[model samples]
Target: MKKLFFAFMLCTATLSYAAEGTDTTSVMLGKNKVVIHNDSLGISVSIFDSEGHQWKKTREVNFVDGQEVEQVFVFSPFIPLRKNTKRTFYPHFPDFYYGANLLNANSNVVMRDTKSSEWGFSPCQIGLSLNKQNTLGLVSSLQFGFVHNHFNTSSVIKRVEEETCMLPLEEKDVTTSFLKYYYVKLPIMVEWQKRLGRRKIFAGGGLALEYRYKEVSKYRIDKQKHTVSRDLGINALGINAEAYVGFGSVNLYAHYALTPLFKKGINAMPFGVGIGITM
Candidate 1:
């Protein structure tokens, strides 16, 4: 209701100003200028960008024989009038972030509230613009991530025949123990972007296919370092759901694993939340 009233008042003011002989009234809508023009024939409306380029224009309305007559002389801004010379492919840039890696304890009864940390970097990202305005597009990226999981109690994952389970570590002198892994991911997403003056806002959501390429268990016992490399019953391929939103170059991003981390006998779903910067 308030918006309608404001529009009514603005239209009344524009008509009043237009009646004062070959005059125009202008208003700023964001960085664009909207101008209402009046002449001997009729009244017309036009919109211009901050750089004084005409963005859009509306038809004129003339008063003839005491009745309103509309004139049609408008061009759509979306229609391409010139040849295309812009590049079709461009770099999507990359994001670097660190966050906590959480496991769903309800699915895995043996594991307690395990504290974990993860960090990643996307060194390569390629994009293809789907529209001429570059507002919508598709992006594909390659990211590498490292995760470290710390157990509060003395525990270690041990293989029992065909199954794997976490058992108490026998080494009483063990001061610290943790499991770490590195993984590579490939993600593809559909993204949308909008420009507002000098700043731009963007949002995207997509799916990522990841593989845990390496894993290791480390322990410091009595000032001595020990390491073990094994399969650990972890799945090789993981599917994830990911999304991001941001203003300008900085963005908040999240990734949730859609599949279990372990192949059998245990259920652990991993997820990460962090901030990302373009480039």
Candidate 2:
């Protein structure tokens, strides 16, 4: 009986020593409850809440004579994963931005006895930044504007009016003539961007389709005005390439069309430099 009592006491002491070697604690983090367990080999963290229990992570740190050799963390899934608090307020995913563009537009076509200058503006541009990495995005815009071409030859002006058949200019009655081409343009592009010290630079190329709805020629002779409107049957499709550098909410950009502005005679390519404002 004494030997049996001695064996039972030894077993109880062994169990106590094993239990004393490990430590455990429970902590409340926000709405979640977390349990931390530290043993000879490692430390483990487990989370429990209304969602039930889940094991988060286990970290191994060596120990020498009951002293831990390194520090470790018990992370909770409910907490944010960012290591830098300064970056916690920044957006970490895709977002949308709206902007406007103002461009000085011109064409590559060389018209005889004509000097041309054109400008375009777009008040609506909707874009999406695909990631917080700010590397890729998409932009789509609608532009409504006009192109003004001044002609020095009355023969050229009369030719345009006679071809459209809507307006005919008398060859002897016209002194000065100019043509206005009104257009509605739509462009969609995929872009890549890089942020550089308060400035962001981007480059992209895409398809731009334009509709020239009305072409009007204005002729002046003897201080009298005459106007003729016609459907110019201009080709409305084009491809464009663009690049931009931005600072804060403002951007300066350049654009070049890869295709001609019109399908037939006088193959004119459109190119422009512009400014944009973002919100």
Candidate 3:
């Protein structure tokens, strides 16, 4: 009989305590429940939040194809998501980025004969960075790229009259010449990206140094050299800028070439578009 009375008293006390704490949230300490990871190229940003998860945003870094932006805090409002905070935020980017560039040029280095040939190179890139806490942020990135171009050039040969025993043609004899060249190359760039509003429209500019060792000319005589001065531009240095519309994993980008296509203006303005990936 005494044991029963004690058990009843314990149960009544437990009920009273639950009633007192019913309307208040529990206070627990730790990191957010989501997981974060960085890619090797580092030009991207990504996040994953599962149900019943919390996080407090920690250190965030970004890379593009292995190159990273020099500066970090170019965006605004630094309210980053914490590590242990709950994963209730939507409109977040997944963990991958891949894209191609349609247009290209060598404004400061080599030049191509056709204006349309500048549209030959197709560049690819990836991005990894943290979510913007406020409206502004300090974001860094890396970028790598390459181009494959194939084109032909034809020029008219003027007529000339000559008195040489070997030549029935005149010194001003009319003739024609054509040349074709093929090249493959790669470039590396580093730049910062800024995000605004929910749509995340941002612009970034960076410098890339490229190397091209494969510019081979096909001669009229397959067995003989085409010209005494047959040299392809192997090493070229230049600059480029890009504007992108950010929507998590998808980004619409517009790119431009700041340098001329050769030692002189052999190639004209170069630009093009494709898809881009953000982590």
Candidate 4:
């Protein structure tokens, strides 16, 4: 908005210099369309259209500074209006286009696929989808994405297995710390959207699947580490529900992870925000 206002002001200021000695002048637009004649401070323009209406904002009447006087000729406004006419318009796009955002996710929780209560990144997989957002609406796109989570955690296991705990039997003692199953994933949610606003507002949803490349779990005791990892074929996948608002190609979005990020019985809620662009 500021840029547009500044541009308008700049054009107005530069008009005087452009006017020069060219006082009495006329600008003609094709046959029987429109004509503009100008002097120093005054402008005169005429339009007699046989059919369609042609319009230009400031582009039409850029009369330079002149004392002779000028009359602004907004020919298009004078032309008769048409009911149904098809016209195409191009929308502005960002430099990196749509799918070029460097994204990263962080959290405060131990990422345990079985326990959501652990303090850590609950999302075993966080990724961005490119194919999901090809065109702003109803068009296909390629999605670039990633998923990563890891934690070196130690929890007091005395609740169920106090006998095995090194702490005093009557009081909470040594805590059992473990570096359990860590997984890094990359996946895409191929999806589409419906155009909802003049500023590119849209709402859509899609499926996101993750392929885990690494997984390992271990228990640490007295400087000694032991393996305690489990496997579930990287089932860390779910449906992505989203809502968004945008301008041109730029957009801001929020999403909810409907599927339980971890196996049942874990305490975790997955939600996130992101900045995106339309391809």
- Please, what are the lDDT tens digits per residue for candidate 2 over residues 126-241? 56666665476677777666666655434333225323212234567666666667677677777676667755555655666666656666767878867644445455555666
The residue-by-residue lDDT of candidate 1 on 37-152, one tens digit each, is 66676555565655566643234455544567866656643122332224343333347877777666443333332457888888888778888877878888999989887654
Q: In model 1, which runs have C-alpha deviations exceeding 4 angstroms?
A: 1-93, 106-115
Pairs of residues clashing in candidate 1? none
Give model 1's TM-score versus the native structure: 0.62
TM-score of each: 0.62, 0.47, 0.38, 0.32
Ranking by lDDT: 1, 2, 4, 3
Q: Give the better candidate number (1 or 3) by lDDT.
A: 1
lDDT of 2: 0.51
Whole-model lDDT per candidate: 0.69, 0.51, 0.35, 0.36
Give the per-residue lDDT of model 4 (tens digit) for 16-57. Answer: 466576543333334334444445445544444434354333
Measured by TM-score, how close is model 4 to the native structure? Answer: 0.32
